[model samples]
Each structure stands twice: as structure tokens, then as C-alpha cells.
Target: MPPVLVKGALHFMLVYARDGHVEILKYDLRCSCLSLVDVPLVGPGIHGAAILMAMEDRSLGFAHVDGLTLHIWSREMDFNRVASWSHRTIIDLRNLLPIQNTDERLRLIGSVEGSDTVFVTTDLGIYEINVKSQRWKEIWKSEKFRALIPYMSFYNPQ
Candidate 1:
């Protein structure tokens, strides 16, 4: 629901149709310029199933979950400054999580700053997953569905 900041710009996903076709827009902080970024066509019609994140190298990254599969993409730029998304990683949620029902929905709540960990919410509980290691553990459980937002800030208790 919130834009990710990378390379001095804020990148956000925009759904311009009923079927959930997404477009990424980059807003430059220095020049205040807004431009469209070219990303590969992800699965359509799965509303609220995608999230934009800042990669370790400070580039734009995207994650989308379809059924039991999770897709991750990273943005790349050519010599001429042309931008595109490169499909990077795919993880099977069934093997990663302790899932009982195949029909239970999985939503990517958010990602931890400065790490590859992502928070996923399901009927069972909320789990933190390390995308690189494929390791996960349940962090919280709730009777009703809950959404999580990752936030980071410096504390100065002076």
C-alpha cells in the first residue's frame, strides 16, 4: 500500500484496471520527475497480492504471490538508462511454511528493512521468511486475519 524508496526516488505500483494490471512509477526526489518503469507482466486479477520493496543494492524490487508460488523481481538498467525488471527468485510456500489447507490464502504483508526477510500472513499465523535461505518461522498467530506494516527509524533519546 506504500511506495518503496530506492536510488533517491519513490517507486509505487499503480493498478489501472479492474483486472489488476500493475504499473510501477518512479518519482525522482532531486528533480521531482515522475516516470513509468517497465516491469514484466505479472499475473493479472490478483488484487492486493503484490508489493514493491527496496533491494540491498538500493534498487527497486517486486514480490508477487500466486497460489503457493512466490515470485520476486529486481529492476535493472541498461547503458542507455533503459529500465526493466529481471525475474530473480521463486519460492514455493507449501515447502516453506507449515500449511494445513491448500486453499488458505497467503498475503505478503511487508519486508524488513536492510534484509531479505519478508512477512507473510495466513490463516495459521504470520511468518517471517528469508528469501535467500528459504527458512521461515511463525512470529504471531491470530484468530482473525491481520495485516502488518514494517517500519524503521532511528531513535535519539537524548
Candidate 2:
């Protein structure tokens, strides 16, 4: 959050609400600097328990961000990460679209091989989240799995 602002340029703010609502606020001290992108309640949310993904996102399975334990998967490589040792504790922070299938399998899945991207797939579709790359860019995704492209992340003015 530390002055991503250019001396006389514009600054952008992306706000996410509890209801999956988002507001993009822009300020340039120049033009209209205001625009709205109404992201209609896109994901699936089960009453009281947690939110799920809509069929639109092609999410196969979703692990509502209410607990720890993560699952990552890579289909092309046919390798899945049931448990990762490098992630440490941040992996426990919270989750959105899940990237593994061990939970759905209920028998605990193992890891895939040679796959760079890892994710999960539900009847709705597939949801994948990158563990290291925080950058937002579209990758060649499969109908088997829809990529959860992140447009914004928290920054500490660094």
C-alpha cells in the first residue's frame, strides 16, 4: 500500500466485501477516475456453512476458507500435491477455489508428477490457485479446471 501512486498519475483500489462483492476505486486527480465492475455473485455459497463455486467457474470442488489443510493438483502432469512441505503455515491462512481432489476422494490423494500448475476440479468445474506466483495473468486452462486468477493481493507499503 506504500504509494503505488506515481507523482501525478492515478492510483487504483480494489475492494472485496464479505458477500463476494467488489469495487474498483480509481483516483487520478485528473479524469473521471471512477468506474464500477459489478461482479454478480459469481461463486457458489452454501447457506451458513461456507461458499462454493458456481458452475460458471468450472469448479470441481471448493474448500471454504474456514480451516487449515490444503490440496494442490496438476492435471496435465497428472501429478497432485496432497500435502506440501514448503508452504509452511501461510497455506493454512484461508482458501477460495481449491486445487486438489483428495478431500472429495475422501481417501486422501497423493501428489502428481511434472506439473507446474496445480488445482482442483468439481462437477461445477476446476479451480486452481498458484502457491508462489501472485501475478495475475491468464494461462491456458482446461475445462477440467478453471483457474482462479487473482487480480489483487495485500501489500504492506513495501
Candidate 3:
């Protein structure tokens, strides 16, 4: 669950979760390849949720959470390069959180390295989602679910 850096020429990308069905692996530091990336299948019961992001034109991006509905995928390249998986955005976290239902369960808890900003966990807390500006807040307040490790930095004291 650790290997997702892909910017240009693919230096890292590895996410393999079965039962929820997902498999993506790409690492090619100038021909030292390690392929297998054609991910686009998650419908039948959507098991382990999903996460793998690095988009902003750098291609390769997929984030899936089916319940409160958040499914965004993008990995496109044609003209012979051949690489597909395009179904871009569909977020409906009850129209962006403040959800007051019950039965708790909504976990994505990853992303925000180079930024697409995603970290969601709701027993009623921990939410900082931007996934292309659908904006969000409430950055911490747990009760049950836990697994969040996303760090961002920018400081200048002059």
C-alpha cells in the first residue's frame, strides 16, 4: 500500500487489492520496466475501496468509494500509446459531508502527496477533500475508523 509517485516516465505506482478487485503496477525508470496497468472495473460489491492519484495532466488517477459515491478515474493515452480508464468525476458524499445519517462507514484515507487532496473518514470526522475542487473541511475528529497518513508542506519564514 505504498508506491505511488508517477509523474513522468513512471517512477512508481503499485496498488493491488483483490476481492475489491484492483490491480495497477507501473514502474519504468528508463526501460527498467515493471508493467500492468489497465484498471477499470469495480462494480459488483466494491470491496476494498480505492486510491491512486497523480493527475493534473500527468495522467493516471483513480479514486473509488462506492456508498456515499465518489468515483473518479482517469488514465488516458491514445494515438498508439494505448492506455485507458476514463470516467472522470462523480462525487456525492451527500453533497460534501455534514451527513447526518448513521451506520458509519466511509473510508478513503489517502492521497495528497503532489496534490489532488483526498482524505476521508467518517464516523463524523476527518475530512479534507479537494479531488479537483469539490472542496471540504473538518480536518479531524474521530470516533472509530482510523488510517490517515497524508502530509503536505510549504513554509517560508523570511
Candidate 4:
């Protein structure tokens, strides 16, 4: 179970499982815990809290909601939230692979090893997002990548 500590007093916990299982379990947070008007929610992930989207000045902040889109706070103090609002860009969440590449996506993960970026994989290829620019680009595009170097360690035989 992962938890998000908000405003100090409130605790938001996210529970997850496979598609068939209920993710949230006995959470300290309930729909009533909020201010009624959806302020901004920062979701919890496997290890830490993840913003379906986030904005930062120097430190990191996260916000995310399942079923709804991910919202990030942006740096432009005038922009207000962690994610930008003036631009209002909507990213299609469908067809995106999970953030966890520890499983079969290990090979896909290796490509972005050195850089401080996040990769979103699809049948199309691997797209790396620049943390600063929030821009996404394709770094690799073959199924063959799934068979390369780190992807081929015989010890962890798939």
C-alpha cells in the first residue's frame, strides 16, 4: 500500500492490484475528506506518490487520479498548478505501458539508463520524455530491442 501525505493532517493511500482486483483498501482518505470541489490530487505509486502529472520549482510534487487524467503542477508561478494550465495539452493515456519496467520491459528500460528521463513504451516504440521540456521523442522502434543486451541476461531467463 502506498500513501500520500497531504496538508499534513490528511493521508491519502492508493491500493493497487491486477485489473480484476480492487486497488484501494481501507484508506484513511475517503471522498468526503476532500473539500468537495476537486482541488488537485497527488496519487500514490508502488514506492512513492506519483502525480498523474506534476509541476515543480526545484523540488518534486506529484498529482494523479485513476479513471481521470493525470494533472501536474507547473513551475511558472503564474501558471499556478504543478502542470501547466494555460497551454492545456491533453496526453492520450491509452496505449501507454506502465512505469514499472522491471518485468518484460527491462530491455526497453535500459535505453534510458543514463539520462534523467521517463520512458513510455507502446507497440509503436519507446518514447522518452524530457523532464524539463515535457517533450516526448522516440529513441528505439523495433521489437528487436526487446532482445538486446540487458534484455538478454540468461540468468534472469524469461
- Which candidate tops lDDT? 1
Q: Estimate each model's TM-score.
A: 0.87, 0.21, 0.31, 0.29
Clashing pairs in 3: none
Give me candidate 2's TM-score against the actual structure.
0.21
lDDT of each: 0.79, 0.29, 0.71, 0.34
- Residue 73 Cα positional deviation in candidate 3, in Å, after optimal superposition: 2.1
Q: Distance (Å) between predicted and true CA of 97, model 4?
A: 14
RMSD of 2: 17.2
Give a tens-digit lDDT track for model 3, residues 74-114. 88888998778889889899878886664556878677766
Clashes counted in candidate 4 amount to 17
Candidate 4 per-residue C-alpha lDDT over 35-107 given as tens digits, one digit per residue, 9 for 90 to 100? 2112233223322223222223331233322332233332233444543223223344343333332233222
Instruction: Using TM-score, give the best candidate's number.
Output: 1
- For model 1, the stretches where C-alpha displacement exceeds 4 angstroms are 143-147, 153-158
Looking at model 1, report the run of 10 residues with the lowest lDDT sum: 142-151
The predicted structure with the larger TM-score, 1 or 3, is: 1
Candidate 3: count the clashes: 0
lDDT of 4 at 2: 25
Residues 37-141, model 1: lDDT tens digits: 755655574457777788766668888888888888888889999777889899999888888788987888888754767778877888888888989988888
16: Cα error in model 2, Å: 45
Model 2 residue 57 CA deviation (Å) reads 30
Over 4 Å off, model 3: 4-26, 33-50, 53-60, 64-71, 82-87, 95-98, 101-107, 110-120, 124-158
lDDT of 4: 0.34
- The digit string of per-residue lDDT tens for model 2 on 1-158 reads 11123323333324345654433233556664654322222343321112122112121112223223343321111256332212111243223443344244211111111212233333334444443452222233443422233243457995
